[model samples]
Target: MNDSADVSTSPDAPPVTIFGPDFPFAYDDWISHPSGIGAIGPEAYGQEVAIIGAGMAGMVAAYELMKIGLRPVVYEPNRIGGRLRSEPFVPGEPEVAELGGMRFPISSSSFYHYVNKFGLRTRPFPNPLTEAAGSTVVDMNGESLYARTLEDLPEIYAEIAAAWDNALERIAGFSQMQDAIARRDAPEIKRRWNQLVHDWDDRSFYDFLSTSDEFGKLSFRHRELFGQVGFGTGGWDSDFSNSMLEILRVVLTNCDTDQHLIVGGAEQVPRRLWSDTPYRITHWPVGTSLSSLHNGSPRAGVKAIRRADADHLEVVDSYGVAKQYKAVIVTCQAWLLTTEIDCEESLLSMDLWMALDRTRYMQSSKTFVMTDRPFWRDVDPATGREVMSMTLTDRLTRGTYLFDNGPDRPGVICLSYTWMTDSLKMLPHPVERRVELALRALDNIYPEVDIKSHIVGRPITVSWEADPSFLGAFKGSLPGHYRYNTRMYGHFIQDDLPAHQRGLFLAGDDVAFMPAWVEGAVQSGLNSVWGVMHHFGGQTPVDNPGPGDVYADIGPIDVGD
Candidate 1:
């Protein structure tokens, strides 16, 4: 689940890679192994493990460890759900604006496994011109164009699509690589992927597009259109300077398309895990939950972490309460390690610290407002079409998402989803001002529609960059940082770490192959589970080979090379 990049090539030139030259390990395959992951002996059962952050990664790791008879105490200063936040704009309503982790791609099987496990209902997310999205209006250069299908757009759009396809197929064997990925052909995937990593790791996503012969053939207007009306996920000009590997991972893994959003709220996944008793384990009651394991609510934010003894670490909560645990798993954003929490200088190795400090997070802002009803669904008698549709524009609003709760129920709209500089522009504005700015942008797009008349209750907007807890929306690595990423991604392997860092573990989207996807968080959690199990002399069932057990054969190619 990494980002993607572009590569330059002609139809007759050598096939290029898109995601990266790095091996995109099939975490789904590893987790699905028949033998099941390794387990600790009864002697080590019921031990205490501290988990920071109650997000997907922390919750998943805690749940799995609980299944093995370990006691996991989660600490969260704010609400339980971390980035998967769903805000209820109005009281006693089913409508909610997903403040974080909205859309999930079907390719993220690792994340889906838990969703399916919990029987959470999901619906196709409305993205761009997709049927599920209803209708799309792309406004650019003061001109508004409506499209129910790709064909409805100007011929320039089709040409751009063709160029993109040619660039992907000719340079990266896009279809073939996806096929290899679907088949879980590790050897073939590695061989094809490694070459891309080596060649494109240092290249920018924009570089890939500009250097391509297909793109070169097109007028600059086509390229601008392509950027404004991106495929699958939508406009990515904000990520133009990002490593091509980041873009490649999104496209190659199918993480950008065929997406679904959890019904009710994505936060329910972790919130339910806290109280749901799915299975029984030794040393705990048959119906034990994470909340019960901690006696009640989670601890406040961690203030500091330092070694207390040779075999234990002390965690001090915000109230200055110190507790010793055999191990600690940090699932918070990497920046929090250095900025929010005070850690002993020697707590982590210099290499690991550098990796954590250097992690670059992309700024993201989302503004959501609830309407009394599905006002956008109303058809204009004069135009014979819905007044407003899912919108994509180069304006200040950027990308907008629409959510219809029901025919009569209230609906929510993500007025804007701006990234990088676009997101930064709203940093100084209050929620009300931000909402006004978005309404102004929409007013221009749909001059005939009175969007403000339907506003109900209050609006919720967030700038992740302004939030200290998260620091930023998610990691968006730059070129030539593959080695640093690899270091963080594989930090769970305690054998490779120095003795002092052995008991500490890292698990989050940032430490995952797919930085922005929940699937990466899930996989990273599972990785830590395997790591902690091994640290305590636990063993997976002989049939279920852990990731580390198979690392020598299928691990990602060393970034240094």
Candidate 2:
């Protein structure tokens, strides 16, 4: 790790991308003495493990593998937590801010592991009860509208939520049978997921909403909530699946452990995980894009393009100065990885590419408005009282986050807004479009106040999802998509390596699970580690099973049908 911190400056003092105690961990013969720094050893898994993209998933998997006696070599082009970037904002310098994956919902098991082991500071991120929707925000029809709380909301809309709850109990009750059928075959799974749950893959949220009682009861809310407020309609209609709704109930509702906020931001999670590890993390600037993916027997080759037109991965870096791992666990957004990695014609074959296409990420257009003032100091919607902090920023910014920042922006409050699906891809470039979007949104909220005045400075529109290094903010699933992805992908295993060949299998958010956010990525990466470990023993470790079904982890996710 470099002492000088990796940050950007704008004729002003730059905030520190990395700060805190120095490289407190030791780097001994990590390649050989695997047990020195981390919990695991190189020989524990019978071979070395290599992970690419040091984001939450990659890093967490690293921690797990190390604990189980696997020496995993992590390969990250720039800073770890690929998109959990936090640019600094120094007074009189460059404009840098934190880039949180928005904010975190309760995390899955794997996410919890890495965060707690690191001992990250904690804060409360209680659910939202009230919010303030500004006049500048658009409605389902792209017209302006104002809102406060669910109760303060339009009476018709309130009745819909009540209806939705009633409908949800009836519909969600049927999910149990659907889960069982989904595992049996695609057609049967599609039937339930599409008709009862929703037909998301080929339809819009609008089209799918009508199929469910919840939406039927909340017709008004559906037209506005799912159509314009939540997932957005176009991308959902254009390219998505009905499976998202059900899966989300599972994703958002359950977590491995209790949920809380990272005091400083998400950065503390990875920063601490990197602690006591043999491999060192060298932070770089905002220039990390992949170029190609070549299969070298057991070892897959990856090429990247950095800021200076320099090579990113080892394949791109000559003389192989880039570290080569026996196995690579890719952790960035799949689309970003796709751009840099070459899919051989065979890999890109219609059968394969079609599957790849199904696993694409959703686009976003957002701005993080930082201020020195106590912005979220308005009336509390959940309770008509003085509000301090909560999740209701959605009401305040029309579903955009308005409390403090993600690891990308530490301490300061940020109001985040995004357009799901194709609406995002239509936005302008970063430099011009990013700031413009923030200012535009701010102008609406503050109206006559030159909101820029409180601006210590931020990357307003840090288009990380669009960054070649990361295709989108996070991965979402369509109906029946995970079936093909997990069963088909992650099939390339290290043990499948030719007798004398040295290779590593890679897995991450994009590899399986249809979606590529924190949960999916961490789970997939964990699967990769076990797969490599299984390769060595000719069988899976006693603790885990192959294919890594979450149901397998917790003895089948109860459908409650």
Candidate 3:
């Protein structure tokens, strides 16, 4: 069935782009994400909502806010699209980069929408079929081997006729169920669905599969295949955070919608949004350090000790660019709101903070080797001779984490999906040493591809986990992380707190959909806008944020005092 899933394709296209376990996420999938379900926003107009990040979530919020007639000003300290990057190295050499997380599941609905919104082409990327087969883990004795080639694999997987159909159908069914649940308004039905989500959220898919011995072993084996097709691993193995479940649902639905890749790369997407908007999106030296809040209260707006050296919400740049907002909607991570922001200790509970700290955040590095000549062909990297993703009758597996790209750009460019986030903590090297280690790993994957030797220029190393700007790759919400308990946005915005319009809004992965990939960020932006719009109780316009707007969206964020 895996073979059958691998649809026949035109010779001129990226081999894996057509279909199968190796296809990348499409950009048109519309997920019924919480934010996608019902937009949050203004009871009035001329309200200011600041979207901190420029990724999909933030962009979605911006769009929603505009629709609601709220003036949203986006504040990005770096290029938009958060982790998306593409740059010219040796003048002629153009490389797309993902300093943070990258990769789109072909079935993710929300991802599909963004791809279309940006008009970025999503061509199939090279798979092991077109290139040479790469490597993944295996037992020393090779007993637990997971091979891309069926010639050397077990019979169970080869029973592709049944297992393949069952798994795909099951996965699809799960998607439908989730969609149904998302669309319904019944409290009891939602309660049951949430129960299932919560039950699964407490342990690994491995644990659930353990109910059946065949399932246990098959799942373990299936995990290996995931690597081959580039799904990769997550912390869901132990206990899945609430956000993790949402992420899974979203990625699984992309094939059914339309998400676009912005032409010229993702960074261009946000840049366009920022430029097209009437407000300014200037970069300040905002990293992961803490900043002090001062003279803050319900009656008067909050003032802060803005500093350039401070990596957290500096609200000021070393270049003396300290500005104020009537309303600020942070579009970073929810964790940023929890740890990086400086506010009263009473804003959030200590139990909440402690509970958050227990969840371990994995790290990974994202570096791209874009050269003038595609030197990957001459040298073969596999243990034996094999053709990667290009040929029809060839070995198939993962590419550079990126699913597809324009045909003009032939070589692979691994972005955020490289998944070095959790691994960064183990990288015992500076930029130079890290680059060497990465090259070694890349060479291992594509032996035919040589970077150190044919490498044109410097390989860009971005530490999403280490970057002071972004402490982690994404936001998280572990099991039972209920928004009501935290007086979350749904309720917080309704509170008669004087801080509502102190220009403090949170537009991170936590705002809405709390933990569901880029969808949360987009939703958070909308949530913050809603918070601000509702704060004024119809006093302001509910449309695009203008310079005159002043509202912040950080009601529930928990930064250390």
Candidates ranked by TM-score, best first?
Answer: 1, 2, 3
RMSD of 1: 4.2
By lDDT rank, best first, the candidates go 1, 2, 3
Candidate 1, superposed: residue stretches over 4 Å from native: 1-26, 29-35
Model 3 ranges off by over 4 Å? 1-47, 59-71, 87-94, 106-115, 125-192, 217-263, 277-326, 338-340, 346-360, 377-422, 439-452, 480-503, 510-516, 539-561
lDDT of 2 by residue, 415-490 (tens): 4444454335435555445555545654554454454555554445555455676766555555555444543344
Model 3 gets an lDDT of 0.40
Error (Å) of candidate 2 at residue 133 is 12
Top-TM-score candidate index: 1
Candidate 1 residue 81 C-alpha distance from true site, Å: 1.3
**Pick by lDDT: which candidate is best?**
1
**Tens digit of per-residue lDDT, candidate 1, span 1-561:** 012332222455332222222535555655566555556788988998999999999998898888777889898989988999988876555678888899998777777777887899999999987888889999999999999878888988878888887798888888777766665667888888888888889999989899999999988888787777788879878889899888878888777877899998899888887887855455577888898888879989998999998889899999999999888999999999889999887878888799899999999999998888889899999889998899999899999899998887888889999999999999999999999999999899999888899988899999998998998999998998888888887888878666877788899999986888898888889888888888888887776677777776777788665
Residues 1-561, model 3: lDDT tens digits: 123332222455222221111111111221223223222333345444545556656666665555445555554555556755555444453355545434343433444455555556654323332212332222212133434444344554354224433453353344343333333323433343444454444444333334433344465545444323322222122122233343334433332122233334556545444434322111112221111101111111122222222112234322445554444555565455445544434333455445344433445555555554444334335545322222111021112433233344545444223333234433455656655655554444445544555455565556567765567555454544433224343332535543322335545554443343454444444455455555455333333331113213212223223
- Better model by lDDT: candidate 1 vs candidate 3: 1
> Ten-residue segment with the worst summed lDDT in candidate 2?
18-27
